[model samples]
Target: MTKKIFASIVTICGISVMAVMLLITALLNGKTADSAAGHVRNESRLIASAVEKGGSDYLYHTDFDKDMRVTWIDSGGKVRFDSHKDADSLENHADREEVAAALKTGEGSSSRYSETIMKKTVNYAVRLSDGSVIRVSGVHSSFTAQLLKLINPILLILAAAALFSALAASMVSRNIVKPINDIDLEHPDAQKSYKELAPLLEKLRTQNSKVSRQMDEIQSRREQFSLMTESMTEGLIIADPKLMVLACNTAALKLLGAGDFHKGQSIYSLNNSDIFRRCLLNALGGRRSECILRTGGGQREVIASPANSIDMVCGLVVFIMDVTEKQELETMRREFTSNVSHELKTPLTTIYGTADMLASGMVQSDDVAQFGENIRGEAERLINLINDIISLSKLDEDSAPRENENVELFALAEEILDRLKLSAEEKNITVSLTGENVSMPGSRTILSEVLYNLCDNAIKYNVSGGRLDVKIAHAPQRAIITVADTGIGIPKQHIGRIFERFYRVDKSRSRKIKGTGLGLSIVKHGIMYHNGTVRVDSEADKGTVFTIELPIEKKNNEQGEII
Candidate 1:
């Protein structure tokens, strides 16, 4: 706009200056031409009157401008005297336009130009009384020559005018654009600007308002997306087709073991492992891919899916789940199935073999009773194994109803000790009960099983002459039970998995102890069902202590009701 304004001003000023110069030049040239013609006519009449008195001597004696010419011709068309030429060589004046006119009308005037029109001649003729003609002529500048004579001045004036126009145009253009430049686009004021620009300002204000709304909306959506992604427990990542990380959550950073994560960083910067790259590249190629990535923290399942738009793969979204616990559970399930099959097969095979031998009557009469006794013992072992299995299944599935009752921990500990008295005797272990007889709201059947398992494990694993102590205490809202045994304590490495089903510290010793390995597992699950916590303390070759704390008031557990 500024350039346009400046150019327009300069163009208009140049045309106006040139127009004024042309008009002035034409007026001056016209006045000069008229004055020169008048001078020639006056000089011709004076010369004619002088010729009537002083004839040809007046033409010779009179000194005029070098540009002036004089010619005298006789009535018979012969040139008698010439100022700038020989009278005999001059052309006859009888046929000349000015002289012919003067002879008929007494006076005549005419103008002629050179071939180039650069010089003009103004001629005036007069007829003398003695049948002769006198003519005087003067050279004058043509319009073209006059214009050429003023060319330098005209150019100088135009140069000065152009310089002035440039300066004035610059100032005017700035003034014309100043209001627009000063306008505040964020918040425009139309009243302070030109009235002609009010409509444009209003339109600008409207556009600003619309853009502001769109910007605010975009910011709001961005914040919402950030909040949602940040709150996710599963690791999430969004990447462009070039594998640049567009968005990532905290969980993704932790899962991928990434540090100082920033947008636009390559996904390989987070984890450059082969499995991660393979899955990501597959997704970038428009194929969904999944793989397990093992890291220092745990195992993660990475699922990468292509984000498609209009049949084109625009980007990718990756989901990472910490499946360490799930993998561990799967392993445990397989091991439990294998161990259960082995354990059930052993007792069944023993019972079947003993009964079959008795039925076949291959034994002599002296061994019949012994055979029967062996069969009964093996059968009882099978039944016990089945019962333990059933108990574990019930705890795992939580498919049985539980009836609430007030159960005393000390009494429960005493009852468990009584039931295990013979086992304790066989091991030559001493048993004792201590602490308050605290009672908590729970199912009596479940509480009995919990106390029995702990006490049973205490006696079963204790060495001969080892002491078993069961302590019960109560807090304001919880019942605490501590069962400690002076048995071969668990090793440090195996302590973490002590409560796992069929997980024995010494498998040979445990098998010889005449007990199933599901007792500790049952104890753990029963305590969990009661909304309680259990912890173990032990050292190799020393003893193991199991401490349990249960809420006095019934509360809902994760699986089912506490009752």
Candidate 2:
């Protein structure tokens, strides 16, 4: 608006200056024309006075022509003399305005009038010595009118020039302002063109850029706010001042189990629960509140807070959170604590009972020794169970042992078979190790422990005369080790839970065999910490094959070799 006003003022000032200049020029032209005409009339009167004073001499001595009429009239209205014809034949001229004025005043005068031979005349009348009139009139043409006629064309040309100049000025001004009109003030190019504009244009551009930058900053802040809201993990919803749904997030959509929540959907429509509606109403009323809502699948706990200082479009932002899994885990933790206490108490009671009997010396010396050994064995079993529990806890923590070192799987498997060979021999189970030497980049102690546990379990659970095989092979990027035993194979239902701590296929059979039920769990976590996987294939009453694949050290191209 201000720019338009300034442009109008500039245009008006330009036209006003041109008009004032033209008016002064026209006035000067008129004054010059009037002065020239007056000078021409004075010169004509001086020539007339000279001729009248020397009339007889001019008529006799000078070569006066017959076509020229030279007459002298007296103040009494008589033609005193005529050069061309009889004096009486001429009309009286003393009564003429110029003649009478010259006779009375004795001064020369000029007048313009019509004559018989000419349409216009320039008459200069002068008084003679006897008070007669001598009038000299020139009838060449309308000289003053002719000069003025020439002025019209010049005036027309000047007017046309002025018109063209005004048009050109307008077009030039528009052309200069055109680029400025299209210039984006927020852009760098607008600032680059600052040196080209006039002072006013430069000022305008500076103001425009400031306003544009301010608007851009506001927009950037708005975008940042939007990103924060959208990227939030917790679900968010916004509503108008009237408490109508306006916007929601992906988490909200999943929580609602609906794809579309159009505008005007009530808070109750989202959950159809009184608790949610009441919470929303309380938030809308400027009271912050938190409510837990149970849906068909799970529970959602939402905290609603009133928004302060809304924009022109008033709205409120609501935050929501899901705590169902956390609640479930809390409940499971409490139950697990009770179950673990019960599980440990039975074994501790058995060990305590055997120790008490041996201390009391209730049996023969040999029997008492045997009872003491039984108590010792039971105590050892309890210690093993506690140690396994501790190991499983360490695995759950996912911590790497400090004893990690490069281990040779082939050597580790051979050592494990050597240690378990006696046990295998007692059952008539043949234990064999088959593979080329292969090395893995991990802890030797942990890897050896894993092999020992697998082999021990295979020998302990195997039927009489069964075969146990340990095979080690070099895979593409890992060392593959398999421990197969013809044991009482695991049932399908129990296979999935075999790696879980304290989980057993048959509780009674596992106890009878003195199994701590933590062997597979330890092996699984040990392999996992080494960036390996443990896979088991088993069938009831047949056998079980446990495969451990651990990554092998590779060259720059990640190609491993068999040692």
Candidate 3:
């Protein structure tokens, strides 16, 4: 601002001074020319008077200045006398503008440039009373010559003026800019500056307030975003188009096994896996990408989505999810479906074959009864398989009854044993229920199912004359039930997966026993529904003991206890 003001002031001064100088020079030149012309007219009139008084002797005797010329012409247009040149050698004066006008008028004057002398000649002619003309001409420097003569002095004056203008411009510009520079931008309204700047200062105040509010709002939103991302179970990462990490959550760092992550570092610095790099690159290319990365922790699903603005990708928002559990669940679901199909097909096929034989009369009258019995038995197996599937589905989807009721473990065990009395008798197993009645809050139906399945499995796997014991007791914050049977015990290798749906320890033996393989699975799910735990202790050719513990309260009493 100071420099601009200084330049403007200097330019205006220089131009103004030059214009004034030119005007003065022109005015002086014009005045000097007029004065010289007047002198010529007066001199010509005086000369004409003297020539009229003394005739040709006055012009011949008189001496004039070296720059001045005198001539006398007769009415016949002939130069009769010349002061500077011979009268006979001079040209006819009647053809001259001043002389011709003087011949008709009383007096005339004219000016012309004389290239020979490089000066302007001013001529004045007067008609003499003797019927002749007397002319006097004076030569003076031209306007160009006068200006040239003044050039050195003009230059000296301009130099002095420039120096003065420089000083004045400096002082003036400083004064003009000082107030503006002194104003406090943070408190513009408090400054006593120029009244002309009041509006600008007010606007500055308004803009400051607006900017302050916007900054606060942005900070608030940033905090909220940070909170949300930090609290997420899924890992989240934000990166620029250059693949530089802008933000990363704790979950992301843990999921990707990236320790002590810092922002603005390359994302590859976190995990330089091929799949990670490929997904990010695809997002930068404006395409949404997803890939699974197997880290030490587990399988992580990385989803990179481009953040777009105006048809152009600006950055990337990446989500990393620990899909290890989800993938395993999906695998289990598929296996369950296949197993259910296989289990149902066998029964349906058996029933279909037996019924078809009976319907087509292929079986003899005596064998028809056996065929009908086979069909009925297969249909019953199909119905039991379907029921078990429905129960397992309900448990998987948490769609079972949630209402709890007080259930006595001892009484429930006795009831289950009574229901399986016929099966126990078929195996020649002696069943006994003992121990005090341990009461707990639970879903009655699920507990009953749990007790019934454990008792039924005991009888089915028992040897002839085996012993079955159902005992109920109490432990700290728990109601305990133990079901022990002298049966072909489960092998150690199969104990872990015995609770899985349709998992049979001995397939052929289980087929002959004629029981759905979902009994232990149902018992496991029912125990889980009551927030209880079940343990199996077994050895081949010996006996297996099933111990179940149900929480007395709805919630577990132990801290950090994993069921």
Candidate 4:
């Protein structure tokens, strides 16, 4: 700024001085021309007086110098005599401007230039007393030649002016800028260095105060927003129209698996999914878009919504939510509906068929009891399936707080084993109970269901005369329950899926066994409600063992007794 200011001032000063110099030169040129013409007039008077006193012969005998030429012309436009040339051979002077002017005006003067000699001539013609004209001409150098003669001196003067201008401009520029440079921006009104700048400085001081306040407010809001988002589970992202990330929370980075993220980096680089990037770009194009991006073994809902201002999309705010549980629940609902429909349809069909036969008298007297039995049996199966579904629905809600009652684990196992003994006898399977007598804290109903499902499944899947065992024990921190059956065990591939609703290892075998597929699924959910884990060990044609572990809660630290 300093250099530019100095240079501009110097340039302006130099140009002003040069302009004045040029004007003066033009004025001098005009004055010189006028003086030259006046000098010719003065010299012409002498020659004219001499001509009036002497005849044409007296003018022809006088010597004329190389700078001056003398001509005498008669009133009839004939050249009567010349001073430097032969008078008889000279052209007529009647067509000359000065000769014609003198004849009309008595005295006239004019200027002309000779191209061959490159010089200007000034002529003064005065009319003689005999109706003749006497002309005296003088030659001078051209204007361009005069300027060439003065070039060195003019350049020397301009150089000296330039040096002075540089010094003066520098001093003036510094004075003009000194007040501004010395201004105390933090406290503008503290000192009055320059009166002219007082108003400007005060205004700056006021604006600075306002700007500082506004900046503080903006910074406060930013910090508040960051604090609020830091601990949020949902991912939040703010990006620009170019899909560059502007702000992203920790959750957003972790959600998108953005390992190394930075501001101004493209959001498309956050993930490998083409569709997700497309959604982000679409949001930038003034549209809201959503996509389910599977990440980290779970589903995430990526919603890209345009942030609009005055009906135009300025940027994007993407919200990512962990929707894994929601999506899983939806899938489970769909599967449950389908399974219920099919499971209910089969038993209802059987019941309807048998009842219809009986109502129409299709069964004879001997077969009537058997048909009635079939209808009752199908109805019972349908009832059990409905109960299992109701239990699963309750578990799915997870809203039911269990009873705060302690349950005797061994006693509950024994009771469940007793209830299943009759069924085990029908299959000729030996049922036995083993392990230590232990207890846990839980709802009695839920604990009963857990034992009954395990023992029932053991009996249901056991081979003819196969052995079934229920074991109960206590670990240092938990209670353990084991149900093992020597039966057609689960296939290794299907073992993991056995707890899913309606998942059968062998459909045909399950049909002959006449068991609801929800029994084990119910057991799994019910045990989980009590904070337990269940694992299975099985091999086809070998045997299967189901083991459960539930955290133990002792009523008294010293007593270690049940409540």
**The best candidate in terms of lDDT:** 1
**Candidate 4 per-residue lDDT over residues 132-219, each given as its tens digit:** 9888888766666566666787688789888998999889888988877888888886365778777888899999999999999999
How far off is residue 333 in model 2, in Å?
4.5
lDDT per residue as tens, model 1, 294-385: 99999999999999999899999999999999999999999999888888888788878877887888888899888888878777877887
**lDDT (CA) for every model shown?**
0.87, 0.70, 0.86, 0.83
In model 4, pairs of residues that clash are none
Question: Model 2 clash pairs?
Answer: 405-442, 405-443
Q: In model 4, which runs have C-alpha deviations exceeding 4 angstroms?
A: 1-155, 171-199, 202-206, 271-274, 277-285, 294-298, 399-401, 435-437, 554-563
- RMSD to truth, every model: 4.5, 14.5, 5.4, 6.9
Of candidates 4 and 3, the better by TM-score: 3
The parts of candidate 1 lying over 4 Å away from their true place are 48-64, 70-117, 121-137, 241-246, 264-269, 341-402, 433-436, 514-516, 558-563
In candidate 1, position 400 carries an lDDT of 44
- Best-fitting candidate, measured by TM-score? 1
What does candidate 2's lDDT look like per residue over 1-563, in tens digits?
A: 43554466456655775566566656665675455446445653554566656655654455443323455677787876665669888787766776778788875555454544333444556676776666554443343444455567656665765666566666767666666676654443634344565565666668888888999999999788768867877788888877777777777767655565775786555676788888877877777889987766577778888886753325567777777887775765675465467557767887788777767876677787677777777678778878777776776675546554667888888887888778888999998889988876777766776888899999889999999999999978889999999999998887887766566788778767866667876787677667677788999989999987777862222211111
Give the TM-score comparing model 4 with the true structure, all chains together.
0.71
The TM-score values for the models, in the order shown, are 0.82, 0.54, 0.75, 0.71
Cα misplacement distance, residue 7 of candidate 1 (Å): 3.8
> Over all chains combined, what TM-score does candidate 2 have?
0.54
lDDT of 4: 0.83
